[model samples]
Target: MHSMRLKDKIVVITGASSGIGAITAQMLSKRGAIPILIARSEDKLKETASGIQGRFGMYTCDVRDSARVEETFAEILHAYGRIDILLNNAGYGKFADFTEMPSEEFQDMMDVNYMGIVRCTKAVVPHMLERGSGQIVNVASMAGKIGSSRAVAYTASKHAVLGFTNALRQELRKSGVVISAVNPGPIATDFFKIADPTGTYVKNVAKMMMTPEHVSEQIIKTMEKSKEEMDLPGLAAFGIRLYGLFPRLADKLTYNVMNKK
Candidate 1:
C-alpha cells in the first residue's frame, strides 16, 4: 500500500497539553498538517497551540467524558470539515502494589487509558467509515506487552488498549481506515511525576527513557507508513518478543532486573 501523506491532513490529538501529544502537534504542524489539540487544561492546550507553526485549533476536553468528546468532535468537524487522523494519547499512570492501589485510582486509569480511546474512537469512526479513509494511532506502552512488578493497574489498562487496537484493526480490515498501536518503554515526560512520584523509576531508567520528540516522530512516521504496530527502542522491542517466546526465562530475567533496582 502507498504511504499516506500528512500534508494538509486534519489530525486530532488527545492529551495535547504536553508530552508526546504536544510535541506531535508541533511536528505535524511543521509537516503541513492541521493539528486539533485536545486536553483538560485550556491554558496548556493554548500554550501548545501557540508553539505550532501553522494553523491549528485547541479544545479543552476530558476524554473520559463521552458527552464532551462527542461535542468536541462535532465542533472539530464543523471547523475542519473532516478528521484524517486521530491520535489517542490521553492517559496517566500511578504505580503501586495491586492491593495498595485505591479502587478509585484504578478506575481512573481505566477511564482515561482505555475508555478514553474507546470514547474518542467511537466518536470519529463513523465519519472515517463513511469517507473510507483515516488513521487511528493508540499510544500504548511496553508495559502493555510485558507485565512489571509495581504497575498492575497501569499495565492492565495498557493491555486493554492493545487488545482494543488489535480488535479494531481486524474489524476494519476491509475499510480504508488504519489502526495502529505504539508501544514505547519509559518516555522522558511529566508522566513520570504521577507514575513514579518518588522518581525511582525515572532514576532507574534515566538512560533508557526515550524523549517525547523521538516517540512523536515515530508515531507520525507510523501514520504515513500505515503500520499495524511499532515498538520504540529496538532492544526493548526484541526483549518484549523474547518474553513472549520464553515466558519462564523472561520472567526470571525480569525478576533479576527488578531486584537489581
Candidate 2:
C-alpha cells in the first residue's frame, strides 16, 4: 500500500483522545507525521501520545476557551516550528427530540461542534497564512446534509461546520491554505457504545458501521491530497448525493423502506 507519509509534517487534531481522532493520530504518526492530540482529558491524551510510534504530544484544553486555544497554538508553533494540518474533531452528539431537548444541550453542541472549530481554526490560520500553506479539515457528518429527527441541534451544528469550511476555503484560496470538510457515516467507536449504549440509538446501524481504522484511513487520504470535501464510504456518499437530488423521495425511502430506526 502506498503510504501518504506526512513525514516532518506537524498535524494538530482536536478530540484526539478517541474515535476517529484517536485512530487518525496513530495512523498519521505511523506514516511519519508528528501529531499533536488535543482534548480535555489529559490522561487519555497521554495514553494516545505514548502509544504512537512517532513523535506525538497532547494539549489539554476545552476548545470553547478562545484565549487558551490561542496560547496553545503559540506553544505548538514554538515547539514544532509550524503546523501543516489541523483536524478539528472534538465534538459530541446529544440525541433528543427538538422540542424535548434542553436548551443548554443545544448551546453545548453549538459551542463544541461549531465554536470549537471556530476557535481552533482562528488560532491556526494566521500562522498558516504567514507560512504560505496549511490545511484545516473539519470533521462534519451526513447529518450536516440531511435532517434527522432526534438530532436537531447536532444536525444544525454540522451544517454550520460545512458552511464554514466552504466559506473559509474560498477566503484562503489565494493564501495557500486549504480548508475542507469530511462527512463520515456510522463508525464503530466507543462513542456510540457510550452515548447510545442502550443501543437505542446505535443498535439499528451497527451492521453498517465501519471501524475506526477504516475511517482514519479515509481521513488521512483526504488530508494528504487536499480534497475539498470527502464523504467516507463511497456508498453513503452516493446515497447522500442521490438524497440531495431527491429529498422527498429519499425521505420516503429512508422512512418507509429502511426503517432507519
Query: In terms of TM-score, which candidate is strongest?
Result: 1
- Name the runs in model 1 displaced over 4 angstroms: 1-4, 258-261
Q: After aligning candidate 2 to the native by TM-score, how far in Å is the CA of 125 from where it should be?
A: 0.6
How does each model score on TM-score? Answer: 0.96, 0.95
lDDT for each residue of candidate 2 in 5-39, tens digit (9 for 90 to 100): 57878999999988889889998988888899999
Local distance difference test, each candidate: 0.91, 0.86
Clashing residue pairs in candidate 1, if any?
A: none
Candidate 2 overall lDDT versus native:
0.86
Model 2 TM-score is: 0.95
How many pairs of residues collide in each model? Answer: 0, 0
